[model samples]
Target: MESLVGLVVCSLLLAVQGLYSPSDDVVELNASNFNREVMQSDSLWLIEFYAPWCGHCQRLTPDWKKAATALKGVVKVGAVDADQHKSLGGQYGIRGFPTIKIFGANKNKPEDYQGGRTSQAIVEAALSGVRSLVKDRMAGKTGGSDHGWQSGGGGSGSKKDVVELTDDNFDQLVLDGEEVWLVEFFAPWCGHCKNLEPEWAAAATDIREQTKGKVRLGAVDATVHQGLSSRYGVRGFPTIKIFRKGEEPEDYSGGRSRSDIVSRALDLYSDNSPPPELLEIISEDTLKKTCEDYQLCIIAVLPHILDTGAAGRNGYLEVMMKMAEKYKKKMWGWLWTEAGAQMELESALGIGGFGYPAMAAINARKMKFALLKGSFSETGIHEFLRDLSMGRGSTATVGGGALPKIYTVQPWDGKDGELPTEDDIDLSDVELDDLERDEL
Candidate 1:
């Protein structure tokens, strides 16, 4: 039994994004490869389960293709068009045009993208969501099943081939020989699906060079891959999944942009993804503005360098920070700052005059903060954060904790050659009454 358990664990590890056999390097997933394709995948998998009879899904065919091409290697990609297999579609609980679902390598429940049903948008959604899911799960957490938004897409089809992911060849799609596969699972009628059409196409074109062989992208219609979808537990549209060689899948949540989708695929260099922590970087302008206004106590510390022009400044800053923390309720609050270890030495007193290696205890706009320079140890970072949270040395802290801004863009009209109205409509030409071209 223990041996069996280990085997199961091993299997799960080997299947982050499942492998696939790309025959022509053109298109490999088809009705014939349905069952074997999905099941053999030991890693992450994004299967588009759809049906041909559904007018909406039929129209979204091209969008699916574009998604496939854009997210080739970072994940396993495949499609299971349901028309060819009626029972398969029903089993997957696909009661609509297109449905995208993702499977983690542990191979338990799959996350679903239940937004709008454009081929491009849905494919992108499924790939994006599944990647997050698989990544989170591998880290011992479930992210995809937690939260995500909806989307819209176009109601037309392009000259792209779409596949249906079915139970029969589901594993084959991932295990046949491809390194990574990112699949699109979507529904056609979803308004958001329609909106995502152009973005999907644009993504494919942009990443054409980056994805090539390392990635194999594809799609599926939830309306088709009944058993496969059911087994994976897809509950929505526009879901995404990433399949890798020897790890369980990393299914991501959120229906986002084409660039984001490409980023997931390229996280492995060349195509490359923005570093995970990059999202938390503070903008230089934002920082500068804050520094100028706040007379609050601020301390900047260097990681390695000492006994230089910056050294005195660093020590003074550190003392100042402690003093401020001690007198927080007494009108002496300080902000903390820190810099990377690689930064140059600082001044002995007053201003370090050193632009780099300045970090720890920063104050501005009533915000008392702590920063680390040069990738300080996680232990040190955590310790500082905990200290700040408790107002550690300070007797009291001003109450005010705001949630991080996690914005989402909603559905909109996406016609060819038409730009995003929100950003394009110029309020500069204000006529108010009879709108006419300004005769300037």
Candidate 2:
């Protein structure tokens, strides 16, 4: 009887362990300790908002554990059952099952993980995030004064990205400039302004890097530049305003965290940027120039004009154009070639056997390429690119380990294809009847 009781106890322990034990690599996060463990900590975190009953989340369990183990020392991996912790999931706007977010330098703003669901992809993305954080630190784009803002008037050499606006140049820089500006009217003596100085400066640097100077952050001394402050109706200690070229200055009403400010600035940048142009691969120069200029070139080989007439071809082009706009921030080059137009190019990219509307993403510098195996729709393309970006997709070395020779070809005429005219054959010279008689 004692032996049977012992066996029952062991079975119970095993069942409990299957649920979640201390040996589990992934930290189980909940409302009780989430803020203290993740938000307040400086370490990078990859958190998954999952539902306990979700099949997809269950399937991802082993891979998530493996990733957590691999990133043991580098990145912290955690999971929260969003179904049980509805408030926490709702806080981050988690609407789907197994949604992952990376909490890096700015814990207040966790970025959505659009990478593959596999362990390798998770590890690559986490390491990439760590590298970015380290780079920013080395560049002095982070950190703040432990004690309040320094007394050095206006701007510092480290905060060069944060432009100093004066009453004299305010109109010229903020109102007249074509770029989107986030201006802060602050008094040097105000404690709140002092506290916001470092956050604002850090945000400015990140915004400048991401937007390529299309969006700017500036500050003004409300006490010294009273006229400028009064003009914008600055009544508070540190009032922030958004200034566009022609639109009236609007109040900046977002969170004060660095991530919040940077996120808002990026949105403004995207709104200002025009949709990326889709070019046709007309010659060697066209292919070389476009591919070399961007990190990745998305090349598509659509069906021949005879197969899919002008209307069908245009429909495919529209899909590409929409995807180009969606991922315009990646700065990838988009080009399309008619089927059988560039034989060498197709051979190098291994796109011949693939029916029509085939796509391949090439990294020219690395001489690597990943072919699209899914449908040529928006969803399929988005998943393919997202996996490639996170280093999850399988890639092959470019044929000949270099770009193939591209034959110069005429551009598509946007019209249906026509068969070449054949010359008439005059066989009336009696060859058929005479040959039959001779053979008989």
Candidate 3:
């Protein structure tokens, strides 16, 4: 009887262990249903391409489930056991365990999640995806086609800013176009084309407004317009081409995300505007003006030439500029002053005792500031900024400390010793060394 009881107890324990399940919020996906459920779905999907035996995937499971729960209706979260669904994993080029890919409107072109592995990071990414979905839907509902008539071309119908191109109108609007053009060549039956419709439409609205209608976004139905498709050598489902007034049609090889497309369009626009200026903290008045900008301001207190000279300071500035370029999406302001130039600012930020090349991010409205504790390299600064953006950085109140008194100094020209003023540089009477003698 005792032996029989022991056997029953062991069986019960095994059953309990086998019954452990993942969160119901996360949909279990496989190779058979991947196309029907993911490729054809209208909702945005955040799928985890993970392996069961991977320790990293196991660790990420909890956070993934939590994010799914939080974004329950806003976004759809799914996971595939890559070890079992090898075909599906191989289809999407998944070579790593626990790879997270965000399938926005464009299902074929998913964006990789490279942010932190924390629950907050997952939630933030999901929210961004949700925003994209809503924006795309808005474009579909309110958008109109350029064909001057209502014709349903693909999934979710036509869009407002996406001009429908044809064999007849392609030359007049695209070839002889004065403004820059971004055209998408697609087919109705193609799954990838269906996915790209929403993203393309949403990006079109933004690009149109941003470029003030100078850059037009259009689409071509490759099947309906066979002449134009054959002429462009369009063999793919969704081939994007750019057309400028005097340039050949250039292929757009960038990512299909709304942000990526918008960024690339702005680059093509090339308005020749200067990047955000790095202000010099010349006086208390300048500090007041800088702090009033509502956005987070990064303040750098660096060594004077007497300590590390201009080379060292310029090198630090270069690092700051690189970081600024990388994170231009955040719209942050950069400012700097010599170590001793702003004594009160240094004291408030505690950078004077921390040595040269110290950095701190300030929120003037909240009267709180967070100082950088790591190296001043690009990666270090990126991590710091990332933490602050995520609200993870430790901050302190101003505590009634007096504002810093700043000394007036010329802007850095990335040169050693005294910089030449504007009046010192001359262009008059300078002969062109590369001039060629031409007979009239």
Which model scores highest in TM-score?
2
lDDT of 3 by residue, 231-311 (tens): 989999899999987678899998775545666777766532334567778766677777766357888887876566677
Per-prediction backbone clash count: 147, 0, 2
Q: Which stretches of candidate 3 lie over 4 Å from their true place?
A: 1-182, 186-199, 209-216, 221-228, 235-277, 283-295, 364-367, 378-383, 389-391, 398-440
The segments of candidate 1 whose C-alpha lies over 4 angstroms from its true place after superposition are 1-169, 269-440
Candidate structures ordered by TM-score, highest first? 2, 3, 1
Question: What lDDT, from 0 to 1, does candidate 2 have?
Answer: 0.81
Clashing pairs in 3: 143-160, 144-160
Which has the higher TM-score value, candidate number 1 or candidate number 3? Answer: 3
Residue-wise lDDT of candidate 1 within 34-147, one digit each (tens)? 334553355556666665434455465566565666666655656665544433443344545567766554332456756655546655675666667667778986322211
Please give the CA lDDT of all the candidate structures: 0.44, 0.81, 0.72
Error of 3 at 120 (Å): 31
Where in model 2 is the C-alpha error above 4 Å? 1-176, 191-212, 227-233, 245-264, 386-393, 424-440
So what's the TM-score on candidate 3?
0.45
Q: What TM-score does each of the candidates earn? A: 0.26, 0.56, 0.45
Candidate that would win on lDDT: 2
Q: TM-score of predicted model 2?
A: 0.56
**Residue 41 displacement in candidate 1 (angstroms):** 40
